[model samples]
Target: MIKASADALVLGAGPGALAIAAALSSENLKVEVLANSDPHEPWPYTYGIWGEEVDDLGLAHLLEHRWKNTVSFFGEGADNPSSKSNIPTPHNRDYGLFDKNKLQHHWLSQCELAKVQWHKGLAQKLDINETESRVTTEEGKTITARLVVDATGYDPVFLKSSESGPVAVQTCYGIVAKFNKPPIAENQFILMDYRCDHLSEKEKSEPPTFLYAMDMGEGSFFLEETSLGLAPPVSIETLRTRLELRLANKDIRITKLEHEELGLFLPMNLPIPDLKQPVLGFGGAAGMVHPASGYMVGGMLRRAPGLAKAIAKKIRDSEASPAQIAQCGWAELWPEDLIRKQALYKFGLEKLMRFSEPQLREFFKGFFDLPSSQWYGFLTNTLTIKELVSAMWKMFVKAPWSVRIGLMGMQGREIKLLWEFMKPKIKN
Candidate 1:
């Protein structure tokens, strides 16, 4: 291993890297942030995070007040040959998107004041030396640290599982469109009704499409597919046709066209990817993004601070306990039910299509709300011993068989993680 060293070596300069740096700095720990690309290159993320995290991080003022209510158009939006009746399925969530560069600048400003080392270089590969990790850059410069965080996006910096070695899925496609006018409203989301009636007859399940529409101020609305999952990728011609049809139905059109085909990929899961031994897998590398939704910024913001605290505790105690392994939130919780919920979310869209408009609204109202109370019960799979027995006695009457199965799968996955925690520890 080459000589230069630091406390932690961060291998990417993405948004998640900013948050990770911020969290560690809070505990008075020094961080080395490696920009795997040119520091001047722009970050393409339409960064979104939960509402509470903004306020908690004290960056509320930096956030645009564009989000209060969001409506997602689900169902086969393209199925109805005559889609005049195809109104989007309105779903609610506490999410917001921001300018990635601005946010990065603010975080870097803070890191500068806090004295976190910002390294400018790309990480070529990483080798774990005895009780340490060394990252070599393209310039042949090397730095070692107690741990390495592979935040290198899809480049698989160090912690990534190989495509031939347990890499589960990479679900996304590219899209780019500029608005003629501000077509999307503030706090009102107009996204791909993947199940909308506008999809081509031949557009089967191959390249999934995650629709994106963000209205930056001025008469501009950014509309394009951000990510797609398990669906056929549509051609530019096909997307153009669909976009034209959508605007026609809404009686809207835009003359100005800017850069197009931005790419967003849904987080992948299942069949535990074989990561290297012992070193920490940070950010999306650990599956922090929800498989059902590509919205991972909030999840990481919520989750990373907890990890920072755990790492701090370990340093203080001068020990890494079995409890530390159990504390690996993403690793323990991601594999189970990641596939089930994602499939069911798509199924839910199909189910919504089966309903009348009013029924569709009612179903969504119940679905998002039910999770608050259920989040606790759902924390463990198969429910508490009490709930399971009650569920059996009551004949599982609360929801559809599909939902019950999904919940069970999620819960079981959680319990298995707990079981693994009970297994003998792999000494670090």
Candidate 2:
């Protein structure tokens, strides 16, 4: 027996799921969200985004703090032993940390205003037909809707998976703590601190890791030690030890532990969903994370409105079939241009996996050396194909000889990947 029905049903209660539910409800669709846990609770992890992205989304007011000085430290300069290699290379862009409580409340308020219904259940099975889909919860309650969207996060429950090669995982362990003194400079955000000054020779020989940090004012700060991408993810324990070492090296001591973020693993370069399936996908389920940078929130926020508009159009169409609606949603999320850009990013990730620690540092040195537009465009997924190619060439020309040789070594695989990317897609 169907316990409930709506115009659209969303599985999962993450920000992505709530965002879409709110948007769809605003479009006059009867939207329902199902999740096992309380959806209104504050998110566990801290989310940071480029300030411009939040401002563009009109969400700047949700930021708890903003830092105008964004810096990255690569290592010590070869020419000047005293100089940390480009220590404090300014990104020239502001960064903001989202106020999770406020952000969640904002989305929840939007959903409430639009009359979106909320249900608490763990979806166990999915049934799809030509007109509507049904999801069965663990307690045997069934809910049906014209379209069902799986926003169930990284390990999707309903979205059909595709064959993918080895995936690299981005792992980090972080903490929010009150320090004996200010750890970082006031209003400073360290985007990537790759310097090994704090690590022992043995630790440095292991897979490279970087420090991601931000100042939260009044001797409180958030610090994370991160492995950008690795096949066998670095363990949380390892990262925790490294974080302690990094702090000790700077003579910084923790006065009180406020929050601990453990085992944050993000899988990158996963295959996009098979768009032929009747059930649509959104958020992590749709492979929306940037392949190289592990960023999704800002992009998801930026893309949500358009996706909502597209889904709403199709849902309102009398003749649109369930499969067609799903296809429309998938295509909107993974358009051809973005698809090609993701392929390029995947290729870059492959190369990064093979880089030695020193080579990795050199690569980023050359990478950041590019015109701010190029590097920024690459990270933000705003560059056209031509611009992306041009950016690669510029980085190659600027890279040190050792780094260039490492890049050259991957030419064979690069050619194969490019060939595969350029191949014509067979439409169903």
Candidate 3:
């Protein structure tokens, strides 16, 4: 039996799905969201974003904490983790941590105000045709819509990419705890602390990891040990052990464990969805996660309005084909130029995976040394193909000789990937 119908049905209850639902409803389209979990519940993980991004999204008020300056330490004096001899590089941008409960409430409220309907069920089967798409839930409920959006995140059930291969991932183990002493400066966010003084020399020879920490007010701190990107991801147990050792080396002891984030394992490189599919994909399923940075939330939020508008415009066109509607949404998310830019980013990730610890440090030394706009644009995926190419050239020039050589050695593979992405797509 057909349980419900709407202009659009979004699958998943995560931030991305709810965000798109709220936006679609605001566009005056009947929107319904289906998820196995309660949509109103607070998200389990912490989300961090650049302050400017939150402000641009008009959701700055939801930030639990903000830091005016961010810093990174490159492990200059690894023999002494706490030594002042290692100078930190300052990134001028402000960083903000989201208050999950507040953020969830805000989006839920928006959806409610727009009268977006919600269904609590897991989609068991999806069927699409010319006029409408139908989804069958686990409990024998059926729903149909003009358009279907899969924002079910990285491991989406309905949306599948055409490309298949092993993917590299970013992993971290984190904790929010009250420390007897402050683990980091209250005014600063530590973006990356590569000091390995806590590890034995043999351990240091393994894949490199870094510290990501922020001071929460009143003696509480959130700290994480992270691998920027890796294939066969660095294990949570490994990161946990390193984090404890790193803290012990700095003479920091936890007084109370306020919260523990067992692990965050996100796919850093995944193929973008095949636009020919009848159903659209948003968020992680759409490959919105930055191939190099593993950031998806801010991108999803920033794009929600435009995607909604595109879908709404097509939905209003009674003559528009179902495939046309899906294409509009998919194209809005992954335009050709953006596709090329992602290819470049994936190439960079490949190189990073091959770097030794020393080479990795030297690479970032040159990367951060680039003009703020260039580096910032690269990290945020705001750079155009030309600008990204220019940034790479500048970094190549600025990089130490050894780092330059490593990059040069990878030119063949880089060129091949770029060529593949740049070639014109042949329509079926």
Candidate 4:
């Protein structure tokens, strides 16, 4: 017989959903986590969990691989990174890498200890009604709950595939690949260097790629940042070809093999995809991505506790949607001509450097407390003016188009004083 009902129904078993279950179960709420797969082993995302979040969630011991410091590499004109401040560590940019499988296993153990319910199957469809909720799976089983959360996240292609699901918030593609030898940096990360931007026309013809990497001590996860004009490989053969020149070259050798790939037209489906049945949206499906950089896990780990709390409170107080993971993702293509994307890029380059650890904590905390913070700080008006000027300056120099795109939309709206406010104003 199909399960009759649940206090809360969580669809998808990724980190966000897991965290939600962990939190809700803690409050003694009857939680059912529907997971389609195990979250271990290498996947499309190299979860670089933030430094403090592990200890905060009491999962610090689960971090099987982590390096303390890092340096960023820029192209020719840009100086080699001097500060390891951005390095993932216990402090500063200190983030820990989840040997994805290890962390998942650890979290799973924790969930088991908590006695949270788990059902395994793919979520097929949901029918929400005025009073109760129902979810039908592909395997001919159904589950219902008072409150339902759609944790399947943003799926641009999937939405196009079925004319269902919400639209995405941006446009991008991503992949995670392992290196043959141990990584180059022992205690650092390599952001996109001139290697990608300075590619020859023939190389460019192949496809533009941006890379982010970490040394797993023995192996590395080379993550490709999604940029404009390219999509992720539709097939493994195409992926091998795209990365063949840069990664699968003569110098690099491969010993172990693992791969995860994803492509997204971020702007394709989002801004609140429809809820089939009184279902709530969570995680990126809730617009949880950091605007300047696309680091989803960091903010996600932080939001889990709160979302769980919200769900509990709603059940207690008889609220309809207790947790509000609002839609705040605001990204369009960095306009080639609009005085927007370029300005945000430059502004973004500066802001990422300016953001302090404590400031970052406060910034994200506010967003969790209230959804508007997601749009307020960076997604404002002053960005527009800066882009207008940035577009004007491009006439003289040929800069990386990526940088230009970042500057204009870094702050979703118009930024009149990005540069003006950088330094303390000169007193009369």
**Highest TM-score against the true fold, candidate:** 3
What TM-score would each prediction reach against the true structure? 0.67, 0.94, 0.95, 0.60
lDDT of candidate 1 over 1-428, digit per residue (tens): 23335556666777677777777667666678787565446776556654555666666666653555555554444446457344554534444566566677766776677788877887786776444567788989877766566666544565544333222343333333445444566536554444434444454333434355655545556666433333332345545555565566556766776555434444343222343344565566554554334455655666667777666555344243323432342343343344334333333323332333234333343444444334223222224434533433342345455544443443223443334334422222
lDDT of 3 by residue, 16-41 (tens): 88888888988999999999999987
Q: State the lDDT at 141 in candidate 1.
A: 82
Off by over 4 Å in 2: 1-4, 77-82, 411-416, 424-428
lDDT rank order? 3, 2, 1, 4
Per-residue lDDT of 99-142 in model 2, one digit per residue for the tens? 99988888788889878888898999988777778889999999
Clashes of 1: 28
Give candidate 3's root-mean-square deviation (CA, Å): 2.3
Cα lDDT of model 4 by residue, 333-391, tens digit: 11122123333333443433333323332332332232222222233222354543443
Give the higher-TM-score candidate: 3 or 4.
3
Q: At residue 247, what lDDT does model 4 achieve?
A: 54
Displacement of the residue 147 alpha carbon in candidate 3, Å: 0.5
Better of 1 and 2 by lDDT: 2
Computed on alpha carbons, the lDDT of every model, listed in order, comes to: 0.51, 0.82, 0.85, 0.47
